[model samples]
Target: MAVFWIQPATFLAAYYHYFHGYGELIASHAADPSYEVALPGLCQPLRIRDFPSFLVDTTGGEVGKLVNDAFRELFEFMDEQGHGAKFLVNTFDELEPAALAAMRRYLDVFAIGPLVGSSAEARIHLFDHAGADKKRYMEWLGAQPDMSVVYVSFGSIWTYSKQQMEEIAQGLRQCGRPYLLVVRKDGRQEDVSSCLDDAVLKGQGMVVEWCDQPAVLAHPSVGCFVTHCGWNSTLEAMALGVPVVAAPSMFDQPTNAYLIEQCVAGVRGERNGNGVFAGAELARCVELVMGSGARAVEIREGVEALKGMAREAAVSGGRADRNLRSFVTDTTIH
Candidate 1:
């Protein structure tokens, strides 16, 4: 009955009956209650308003009702179950100490990840990029100056509208920096390259259908990431010491984005009334993160500190390893 989940622990808490004998791994930073607490160094507490329209209820429309109904069912299931479940979160102690501590008050929680493959043999990419020319991309990256290129991708899912894509294109042009933008062939209506001429993209940027994200982020040329703030992407960027420009859209992305911004490791782009972003706003966020000013320096410092912590946690005999071993021992004993 061992289960690995990316959803909130509340959903896991509801289905404890399914995991009576074995353990469950819940991968997230904040629990349901921790979101309510005023984070120590954050500018403001995270609220429902911070979430995208699909996740929160500000306007009373049919779509909003459907979203609310689904959430209501989820919580109702948890409430009826009556007790909380222990969690093995895909986060480390140093990253979210307060949220982890707060969750521990209610459940037996352990922090044991940046949960990525340590060896090349263990790497498992869900998306097939066998056709991609890794050497070519790496060579391009190698030619660029250290900490000079912006890497942009929004994960595998969550398609952006053509308008949104255009805005991002325009924003990148405005930033006037070297970039590698991964636009999924299936996610957009028109070819992104067609919209932006060869002159704007050829020397200044590289647009690929897909590429090895970790490799790109780890490259010395990648100074900042324009990300959707998915937990895996967030952790990877942190581990690599790459500052972020968060353009979170839905799910736990908003929470991750808030945390990144609060920790001074990134800046969040402003979403318009419809949760869409303008090119100007995106440019502003990118400039803020990529600039050599005081705030950017602070962000780089924070990301570097987190990167060290992530490396230490993943090493043998580190805190995460010890915690994982303890979990295994306890499970075997029982």
Candidate 2:
């Protein structure tokens, strides 16, 4: 089975105990271990905010109810046997070492990813966008100076309200840097051209329905990323050595945003009490990441360090490769 993170894996373990009548097994294991296993608390304290909200308090509107119900069933399926199931996560050791180590106590967890195409391989896009001109975007990016552009995308899912889109546009404009803004046509109330007509005409930014995200992030012109803090996006930014400006919306995004902050790879944009993005705050975050102040320099250094680690983890005979091989070997033996 595939689980995204260790927090959910812990919940799966609890559900396994409930279904298999292994009452207090986790507690007993924690108190007095029967087997030599990598247990929880072996790592440093995790930032409490870097966890999904549902795990903390699941009391809200329809979305919360749906998430809670879905998790309930997912955990049950994950632990049909007395023991929790093994899971393959799309993450690497350096990105979430503590959580990965802690979850190994109850579940056989493997970290194998940044699972995108290599430099020589073609990327496999899940969605079909037959008309996008890759050459045109790449040429535009090439024309820009090194580390001069801000790339903004909120992933394929997660439709933003019109207000949110306007605020983002305003933020990009206020930052006074060239940017590539992606606003998919299907889920929005206005067309990209009409919404950012003045900005486009002024050559301040380029707005598109979709572009190659991995390619864009890897581009030399991309200085900072303005993202919704999705896991894939976070990993991509880390892998490409681009700093981040997180504007988290929901689910795992908030947690990912918190991790970005903890790693000093980026800064989280501030939102109002109503959870609305402010243009000023977005601009501030972009400046904080891309500007040449002391904090920005520190963040840039941190991101560069993480980029090296990510590359090392994914290379041949690296930690991720060895871990994956061991998992395969153990499975065959079992």
Candidate 3:
């Protein structure tokens, strides 16, 4: 009798407690041995190499400490588990067949999503729009030519230093492309209008504090996503048939970026360290990607193809949706 675990990715404190102490924190109250617990598997194991480009520097600042400690805890827990537990990951078999296949030896791995499909049923209405403001964004987008606007957002978590942020802004300005920027309320928000020259701001760009992302992507003008490569964002972007410029900053972002740009054709962006892409290099890369209408066309077509596949996987009778239901049944059945 296997019982599934349900933990939110946002609940890092709990993750730290369970993983860092090897269940010693929870074992006192646990009904059975910790080895009997089933865990949620990631698309890949957390690794120093795979840490967000920012976290790779152990000698770096606070964010590094946070990233390092969290992953350290996670791996430590995995090491203590004795390979006796079943693991289920909410990913698709198609997205990472190799990693999933390798994981099968160590755990009863099941890839059961694009979990956004579940978000629709939550009654949260978190992603839905209000009224006029929503329509204004959407209508502005609708007026633009197809694939004209580049959507730029770092996932809710990551923040950029002012210098780094402006460099990106400069790059975008230099690229001479229309963009929608999501300036999350990190401390980094400054007078960016000063940095961008008049020519660059000629009614071409819009910056919003937060947006209903799923709705925005569904808009006709959103051609590509310049993203941090969060798995949820990746899935959502793919679901919208939008190709990506994967500017991943932290966490599993690099892993997701690699999957898109290297493994799949729908993503393009930078890699840092190991003789890959850096910030300036990434700027160049972004320019090259956005400059080419042909490449954009290719990415759009590829995303559309991927979207069709994702739709089938999440639709009522498909393998992914059915597997998710089956897993729930098996775990919940008496």
Candidate 4:
């Protein structure tokens, strides 16, 4: 019953319908990524570059092609199975009505989430290092005033490049905000660490190998989350009422970025042609979502509203709770 789709229900619904065109588009993007395509439920037009990297993968690695073929097989099975394929998505009804509705037309879709936080009050992500002490970062957050720190974390999968890390460090410096940055130790981090030394010495930032993301997002000091826009991170920010500076990298991240920005919950950062978001652009996006400007205020308001919706949907009598109950009952009876 617990599905691990990091992609939102909004795009997953369309994946069931427009999957047929994906191959042609992938080939087209490989040739020239200049065109935009309209999806079924999304109002914003998605350019070829925004599609999952696996689909338009030009790396000659063939990993993208292999992943694409595997998805094609699953799609073929779904086409044969139809409503027999039941998916429990982690999202709320109010959050993505159109996308949910579109999905239900093709299969049995349940909106059972925005599964925001855990029951455990002392939740900590298990990290294998000295920074593993949950109190280490939590203490830092406690020292800062409410809404003073900007939290930056790209998810665990992709290794950040030295240049990419430098750009982000420079951007955080430009923002001149007290920011907490997460850098994984999966290799090639010594150079990145060296780049961040100047900023850490200035007392403007803290760089940890890894941190408990849920706990950090929940902290009062975290004003804005500069994320890669992974689905779980997106939902956590929505539920916790933190505005985002979405720096989507690959997979469903681009679509998630688009969703948050279109909903006015955050700002999807503008990237340069090099596929690298520079330090200056990074600062501009952080300011847009975190500062006191009208758009920033509006983004905060939008985030707060979605926060309530996400909470309500997961509560006892809410839509997601009710849907879960219904699903259990039907499965038990059958």
How accurate locally, in lDDT, is each candidate? 0.70, 0.72, 0.59, 0.78
lDDT string for model 2 (1-334, tens) is 5455433232333333333454333323332312223224334322333444443332456876677578668767776643446677667778777666766766788887656564423765655677787788889999899999999888888676767777888888899999998877775755545456755647778888778888899999999999888887888898889999998776677667867877899998867767778888989998998998999999999999989988998999987798889878877776
Model 1 pairs whose backbones collide: none
- Of candidate 3, the 10-residue stretch with the lowest lDDT total is 5-14
lDDT of 3 by residue, 1-334 (tens): 2323222131222243345453452443333211232223444333333333433343457876676576676556665664543455656666556555655555455566666643333435433233325556667777788777878877666665555566667666766668777765452456554544432487788776567788788878776787877888888887778778887655566656656754344554645454333456545655545557676566656777778777877778786777777767765653
Tell me how far the alpha carbon of residue 222 in candidate 2 is from the true structure, in angstroms, after superposition. 0.6
Tens-digit lDDT string for candidate 1 (1-334): 2224453332232223113321121212223323342333333554443433344433456875675466556545544544343467788878777666655554556678767654433677667776888788889999999999989898988676867788888888888899898877676766555555542566899888788888888899999999888888888898889999988776567767767876778998777867677778878888888887898899999999999999999889998898788777766765
What is candidate 4's lDDT per residue for 1-334, written digit by digit as tens? Answer: 2244556776675455447655565456554555676666655566665666566667766776687777777778777765656678888888888888877777677888887665334544444555466787789888888998989888766577788888988898899889998877783544676776765856667888777777798899999999888888899899988999998877778778878976789998877778787899899998998888999999999999998888888888989989888877766765
Candidate 2 Cα outliers beyond 4 Å, as residue runs: 1-49, 56-59, 77-84, 118-126, 190-193
Maximum-lDDT candidate: 4
Model 2 clashes, total count: 0
Q: What's the TM for model 4?
A: 0.90
- How well does model 3 score by local distance difference test? 0.59
The runs of at least 3 residues in candidate 3 whose Cα sits more than 4 Å from the true structure, single-residue gaps closed, are 1-57, 60-84, 117-132, 187-193, 196-200, 266-268, 271-283, 287-298, 332-334
Where does candidate 1 stray beyond 4 Å? 1-44, 50-55, 58-84, 118-121, 191-193, 198-202
Clashes of each: 0, 0, 0, 0
Clashing pairs in 3: none
Clash pairs detected, candidate 2: none
Total backbone collisions, model 3: 0
